[model samples]
Target: MASSINHHVMERAEFDRPVKILIVTSPYYKDIADEQVVGAKAEIEAAGGTWDVAEVPGALEIPTAIGIAERMSNFDGYVALGCVIRGETTHYDTVCNDSSRAITLLGLQGLCIGNGILTVENYEQARVRAEVAEQNKGGGAAAAALHLVALARKWGGPRKGVGFKPASDEIQIAGAAKGPNLA
Candidate 1:
């Protein structure tokens, strides 16, 4: 089983500047969500980073919340936390796939987001994963975001500003010949 297999965990990311991460969680399963936040917060603090929390109704809303925060807030990264335990109907699949997809799309758009939402077969599975002493998937997610932030910092050198460029001191017509200065 996955619980029995050993995995390589990356060391906490190093940052020269303060890292501020926004953690968006869905507390549909309050117990699980709370545990996840604990793990995520611990991981962030361990990396010398600070965090703020935002709650959503469910997994599907977590990504939207992150998107909103990305536009309105100054957080360097985001950690998405939630739990979707399988149900008797297809709602489970919809929640799991859609939420995961949205989070991926946001990441592709250059948003630093770590998806920690658990799509588990049962509460027991979610429990083990959410528990800080167990799988600690929340911490794993935070770690992922931190690494991404570190990479962004490393390669994100001076960026060009947006909007129209300023006019040059001397403006020449498009069809003007450069043979002589007609001033």
Candidate 2:
């Protein structure tokens, strides 16, 4: 199994300026969610970063909350935490796929996000992954976000004004300003 193999976790990345991370979590599984939050907080703090958290009703809302925060807040990055276990019905697939896709779309839009939402077969698996001493998926997610932030800072922000630019000497007409013969 993947867990049986040894893996290396990189050291916490350094940033020139302070970083603030927003943690949006779905607390439907309160215990698992809490554990994830704890691990995420520890990792961020260890990297000389600060974090704020918001709770949502379910996994699906986690991404939406982050989207809102991205628009309304000045957070440097986001950490998404939640747990969705397989159920007898197909609802599990919906939650898992939608939540993950939303997070990916946000990331593609230049928002640094670390997705820690656990999609598991059972509660036992979720417990193992969420525990701070075990898999610590929350911590891993935070670290992922931190690395991305570091890379962004290194390259400066995304390229701006990449498209065509109008000639500075070109005359521009305003509404109702002139007829074609006036020029």
Candidate 3:
């Protein structure tokens, strides 16, 4: 089975500066969410990083909170933690797909985010994944975010002006005296 294969777990990433990460979680499943937060916090602390926690109403709100924080706060990265167990209704599929998609879209937008939200068939599965002694998906997610932050630091900064460029005439230079004759 996939679980039987020996996998390399990277050592905690080191940061030259104090890396601050924001963790957004849904306490809908309190036990699962708490476990995830515990694991995430442990990983971040081990990596020489600091973190803040925020609680959202549900999984769907996790990304939204991150988005708001990305715009209004200065966190270096984000960790999303939640658990969505399958239900008898179609709501399960919608929650699972939409939440995952939102997290992916945010990552593609250049936000360093670790998605630890669990979409499982039952509480048992979530228990196994969320347990720090078992899979520890929470720690995995925090590690993922740290790795992305390290990569970003290695690259220095993001590319500037990727999509659009102004023409020569459209570029305005500062400190140059404007000619009075030019209308």
Candidate 4:
């Protein structure tokens, strides 16, 4: 499913420049975040795009970094990678909801922000889903980001910095890749 989605193919001049993408991860679940990082890195490099990584305290900080990156105008796209497992209290809900909303806003700014955040019920679930070496969603998210860039460039032509097509105006993602999609 994920692997099959054709991330846009552009003409030589259309993509004359390899994209610059940012992958920011949270270390709250060190092992999981590490895996996501690896998957995303491999995919980005495989596609001939340049990726730079940034470390944050926890998943809560992911949106902030994204906001910073969004304002920078340096990166053509962003991959916000993190693992937030549900705990005994409502903390998980707060983190998940808040981060999700933030990512939505970021995407609306006309910049492609691929959300690879993992919200699970337990550590085991996180471990399995964050299959950095296998189905690392980080890689999936990176692929999405790049695809969006291809779309943006096509619709508006090239620009000096990141671009976005509003959520209301954006193309349907084909499937539920933005949700609990894992393939």
Candidate 5:
């Protein structure tokens, strides 16, 4: 049996805002990550929001990509998607720890970041969650980013001319002109 989180969750307005998410992944795991990306894209599109995809060489690059995405200011959130299975070395620990730390820091700075990367024991475990037809974590991460974007907009204090409208497609913010003025 599963427990419900209804009492602990926020209202729909918490998830109704348009979101912009960035997905960063590892090229070494493309075979696995491809499924994740597919799942994430489907979820993002279906959720009535827009997103952008960025492919990095490896897990080590997720942090930097997030930094660049943050600077864009158009993205309301981010999603870090990757898979790191344990190998003969201790590299798994290093990657997981470092990436988690970097992501956590971004969250602390008020950027909604959804971490969907998998740190598993083997390929078998990773393959199950990365399935394109099933419950892929990539989709889960995208959902998380959307949810947090809702929550962050609520908690991100106040902006004078902010609009809570959901966007139709990927929203790329360029240089801004001010808000509407009325006398």
Candidate 6:
């Protein structure tokens, strides 16, 4: 039944300026991570955008890395790539939920983000989703970020500090004479 489902992929985003995306990946499964990275890179390149890759120890760290990058770097968007294979322990749920929650929080703060971390029950599921020739969830994630970037560009105008006046405008007191100083 899942195979019968139809997915309608959106058209790739267009950009007037160069788009740079930072990919934060957890290489807990090195092979799977690599495949996902390849797919992400291909998608970004196809959209006339560039990307950089960052590695974290596990899925739990991916969002933290992206948050750091969002603050210290000038990337236009971010792609989160990782795999969480369900295990006997509840640690799996914590990593999956907490990482996803962190990423969502970052997005809410106006950062363009794509969440591609796969939470799968088994290695085969991760493989099918991560493989370039298969589901290519990495590419899907990149596409999601790109779409957000496009929307931000469309709806977001010049950046302004919250509750701050524009730098070009000056406030002057009425009936106050301009004088050089009496501190």
Per-model C-alpha lDDT, please? 0.93, 0.91, 0.93, 0.80, 0.77, 0.92
lDDT of 1 by residue, 1-183 (tens): 579999999888999889999999999999999999999999999999999999999999999999999999899999999999998999999999999999999999998988899999999999999999999999999999999999989878865786678566465543255556667
Instruction: Give the alpha carbon lDDT tens digit for every residue of 1-183 in model 2.
Output: 456778898888898789999988899999999999999999999999999999999999988999899899899999999999999999999999999999999999988999999999999999999999989999989998998888778877656788777755435554335656655
Clash count per candidate = 0, 0, 0, 2, 0, 0
Off by over 4 Å in 5: 1-17, 157-183
Superposed model 4: Cα runs more than 4 Å off: 1-14, 158-183
For model 5 the TM-score comes to: 0.75
Model 3 CA lDDT for position 160: 88
Cα lDDT tens digits for candidate 6, 19-99: 999999999999999999999999999999999999999998988899899889899999999999999999999999999
Sorted on lDDT, highest at the top, how do the candidates line up? 1, 3, 6, 2, 4, 5
Instruction: List TM-scores for all candidates, in order.
Output: 0.88, 0.86, 0.86, 0.75, 0.75, 0.88
- Write one digit per residue (lDDT tens) for candidate 3, span 49-107: 99999999999999999999999999999999999999999999999999999999999
> 5 or 6: which has the higher lDDT?
6
Residue-level lDDT of model 5, residues 105-156, one tens digit each, is 9888887877888888888778887886655778888877877887777767
Instruction: Name the lDDT of candidate 5.
Output: 0.77
Q: Following a full C-alpha superposition, what root-mean-square deviation does model 6 have from the true structure?
A: 3.1
Stretches of candidate 6 off by over 4 Å are: 1-3, 158-174, 177-183
Quality of model 3 by C-alpha lDDT = 0.93
